[model samples]
Target: MTQESQAAEANASGNDNLLLQAAAPLLNAVVQLRQAVTHDDPAGLRQSLIDEIRQFEQRCKQAGLPFEMIIGARYCLCSALDEAAAQTPWGTRGVWSGNGMLVTFHNESWGGEKFFQLLSRISQSPNQHLWLLEVVHYCLLLGYEGRYRGSDSGRVQCDAIRKRLAKLIEETRQPQSESARPLVEVHPLVSSISRPMIPLWACATVAALLACLLYSALNWRLGNDAEPLLRAIYQTPLPQITVGRRPSSPQALLDLRQRLNDVIAAGQLEVSDGAFGSKVIIPADKLFAEQGTAINPVGRALLARVATAMKNVKGTVLVSVFTDNRPVDNSRFASSYEFSFARARAVTQLLQSQLADGHAIRSEGRGDSDPLLPNDSNENRTRNRRVEITLFAAPETLSNHQGTQ
Candidate 1:
């Protein structure tokens, strides 16, 4: 064989080596995951799956393979884990609540199976890299389940993942030549009609139609119709819309919730939608240093940032604070309720001072009433003690409904 053939064979062998390096760990992970599932050990299953993912990631980096391969493999592994989770008892498949506590996975069935199917289509196609990048993005968004979205550390990790995926996509993108279309000979009868008999008249008629459209558009832009038209076009802060005589929160609030989710997810907070409005759940420990109403420096800074986020929200801010099941000494505060109430009041004061337009701020203290996680461990107790601030667009409906009674 010639030197050129030898070189081609060597390159093909190197490609095979890389492929095996990436696939071997994934295959082993799958086998171990299946074994864990067969034994019905949720903890073991979760651990093994995560281990395999890490191993695969390491192997990919070492092999210098494209990120799309890793992403595709990750999707498959996560799907397998989800399936195994289905077979396990519902209570056993727990989520790692960013604060070291294990919380119940709220929606176990929302891992984008349909979206994954669409992604799988790119496996054999030349554009697999681009499509897999999209898959990575979709998976990242899915990982933002209600529980993890409140974690600050979680947000940072997600941002890092996004940056890495973007870099990989940029590196892997391929340029394609535009496909050339075959020219066809025009049919004689159609060709004869194509050259308009009154060319000037045709042009004049088209120009006249364009002028009418331009005049109508200008009139709409300059008149009372402009505001509504523009609002329809660039609807950012979505105004409230009526649905069957019931008014819903504006789209702006929904968008605001997403924005808040992104920010608070980076920190040790969680964002959720409640009946009243959107809410941010902050751990009580983070807010107050051991057993005191005085806000710590960290807590104050966090609240200040939260206040800034809420400044534009035209709604009532409700700061509901709670304590864990542990008993507090009545010497410092009369009762747990009082301590919680005091904490809420302090936060409310800060928000009220910052919020523009004199937005109403409501403070509630429910001592040990709600427990997010079972108070089994110190971590669980820490998670249980939290302050949830809920924001509603407007309280007019609430007031009106109360007035009739």
Candidate 2:
């Protein structure tokens, strides 16, 4: 052989070696991607798939082969991965079109025999479109057989495989001479392969940014100044009511009760002797009636607890305060219900201050209408001059209709 022929052979061998080396990584990436998908790691799988596509494209470029073939392979692999991840059982014996456009697989009873029968029909067909379909069919059958049985026994099988491969190679080759337009348009393939990754990355970035923003907002809202309020809310002072019968799944009710207890405990709210057992009593003087004192420590503590309890509690917690009528100078009751209502409204305002979101509080006072005992005695009157908290079940609950009192 001439020196030129030896150099050409050496270059060809080098090119072949490069192609093989490039293909190894590309093939390994595909396998890793499949494994990632099987393990249910979508992020890992997506990244691996993207890397495989990039590597395959790069290798195809280096080998002087049309990247369209690699693109077609990527498309098929992606389709298969998607189907597998979705748990769709794809049959082994089938025909997949050149562009992975359509797939026809052998169902039960239709095996190699049926595949050969279809091939015979295609061979007899006159139409070019039918002939192409036949070629696709044979190619798919060859792939299927290779994948499953690992055999190529039939006389026509080897020929079919060669023809199908040749056809793909021919389609991939760029025209020697340029016409009005480019022979092979690869821009679409590049765009089609890369377009999905952009959106995936963008969505991931947006989600991460949103998560950070939400965390920051929460931290800022619950800073140092809110500690006293939160503490007062969490440990309220209240008498424990060990009701003989409690609901089977009283988690929601218990949470509310605990929060109220925390507030009562922290505030050290004292109850005046009389009324049904020991109920909390707020002195009218230290209440909202005093211009400077919007809410006493006890009242503030109670309000904080109410706010926290209501956070998880679904229903409305009605709070009402009543004032003493027997005072010699009863100027505060000149407006009667209105003065009492103002006190309730003031408590609601304190509760609102502790809440994160702007929530409306429903409150009303009926003067001394629903007194627990007669106002004849000082002790009985003290009981009447107090705030009452009633927890009504949510409107949506079926048991809410039952009378609690």
Candidate 3:
């Protein structure tokens, strides 16, 4: 195959692999959720909900997706739903708001009939289908609605997800055939008298109920010293990808080390052999402007050299950025993680721009979560603010070597 074609094929394969990886956990979570709801076990339902959301959050991070986890929202509580709805008076609605990604759940009333109806809708609605697609989109390394940029694993993953979304969008837009009901259809109102609002005094009826639920939720969380879980109907997790044996044959390992050494010798970065692979650290002061994601001229030059050195390696490169625990509230970034992610993405873009083929590169922002040094000292905090790049043999490359052996 021509070099370009080979690169294209490798990228497409990687994309599919990542998507399938993310989907595995999600499918399992969905099944568990469906089972919990079907059996009417509220405790199991709540636990499953937490497990699934945590998985989604982790998968999004691993896959390099953009959506943030709303940790403060009490997602699995029926009380949150009731309170949100009760405020509306005439029936009620619950919407996944804040982020432009809106998820609307149809729970007209919190009665026995509505409970069963909600369960039925979740199991058999286009809304659920659309929701799955959205989760996958957000789980993708690419931002939602991103296009295929070509010849990279991350781009390929984005491409595959975009295609899936296109198919879903089309399916959602087309007129429903006779066999398939519209996912969400307006119900016919039989009579106005049949649908009556709760009396104003009835608001008092829920006051005690709401207070009890709030107290219980707070106590449960405070007792455990854990964050309260939110009660939302959307979100899920993807499965983990199994890594192959490391391709660290003595000769190859030596060659890779020598290349890293050559760069380290130039004084632009630091390199050390890590447990899993070779770790390359580039100081943020060198790669980025103060509080910026844009690469400086010096940063671009260093990345170009690193990319050139790594172009022929049959491996994937993970470029992740880390930041100190300093508060980022006054800045444009909403959180430290967002700031770190932007810097990582900026570095990845520069590296990819210089690379021609063979090296598979992706980026992640770890935020202030994984600090390398104690944050108590300014020098230590400064040490924590750096970008780390690591190299690992692609699974296919390792598999091919084993096959030859």
Candidate 4:
């Protein structure tokens, strides 16, 4: 083998060894997970597994291993429980909370401090963050009660984080094109091994004979089968495609638009009614607490006026917050997406009450993504940090009534 091929093989072997080492601590946990999936855990097993995980994490950190490998493995187990429940022969699967004591995959606090630590390591490798995302998703899925739990707003935030982690994994998982490495010439003796060649004309004649026989056989069989096949085809029903409804024109919402105009004029807000949809944009600094997620008094008053004006609007209320591409170090918010989500939820909660009958409040946190302007200058970044509220109707509906997978 060439030196280049040898080096490549060695590198691959090293990576496999490291992954195996990281997964070593979870041997006992996997056994426990099997029992948990069957709902057959023995007494005291829960606390014992939790302690093992906690110690394993501490050791991983102290030893400076990829900090998130353990987290990812535990999450993989939890996800396994969900899959089992889904595939159960017994009726509809309710919530799958069989993750045992690994609710957040840690005995540690599921508060801001721990989350901040996780967020601080966003600069770490994708392998690291995949593990962190596993933990974050645990907080959302495992019936853990917190500010961002069991709420539409929290789900939206978790979804944003999930999307980010997915993208990271996808980017890193791509097969890298190896650069051409210089190779040494092989010996003539090694290269001389060869197979005898067949005559092309003889091979072609054999192939043609076989093809003719196969074609005759097919023709005979098809002659017998053709009538039945054609009959079945003619009797088969055509599929019906469902045409979707489009959004009504903005002219229908002119009265509501005019009412929202006064609120737009009073605050640092922008309004646009276009072919896509009608949206109200409020600057984040004007609508939220400085470097915080809570809506300030001014923002509250402004949103309150908006809610009052749109009380009669009949549709799902869409609230989305976009933050600038800036790293955050606050005690409350660990990342810009979390910050955006919290504010979006705050706005969503305030506006929910005024929603018309059957109207639901949905919020999203698009952090430093899909920016309104490039973050080249401070002014541009500021322009990108904004909140959008849409009086959603049929067109703005991302999915149908049951939601698309």
The candidate that wins on lDDT is 1
Model 4 vs. true fold: TM:
0.42
Off by over 4 Å in 4: 1-243, 251-255, 274-276, 394-405
Task: Judge candidate 1 against the unseen true structure and give its global Cα lDDT, from 0 to 1.
Answer: 0.53
**lDDT per residue, candidate 2, 1-405, as tens digits?**
433343234234323233333444433333333333235344454456556655655655555543323333333333333332333122121221111111111011112222333333333332322213322332342233321232334335545554664454344333421433322222323434334455777888988999898866743433323333222322333323222222344433434444456544654444222211123344455454442225677556555655665564444445667655442233333333445656776765675576554233445544555566888888787667776554433533315422331
In model 3, where do residues sit more than 4 Å from their true spots? Answer: 1-243, 248-251, 399-405
Clashes per candidate, residues 3 or more apart or on different chains: 6, 9, 11, 0
Q: What C-alpha lDDT does candidate 3 achieve relative to the native structure?
A: 0.49
Cα-based lDDT for every prediction: 0.53, 0.41, 0.49, 0.52
Report the lDDT tens digits of candidate 1 across residue range 90-117: 4233442110011011111223332234
Candidate 2, lDDT over the whole model: 0.41
Question: Model 4, residue 128: what's the lDDT?
Answer: 40
Worst 10 residues of 2 by lDDT: 98-107
TM-score of 1: 0.36
lDDT winner between 2 and 4, please give it. Answer: 4
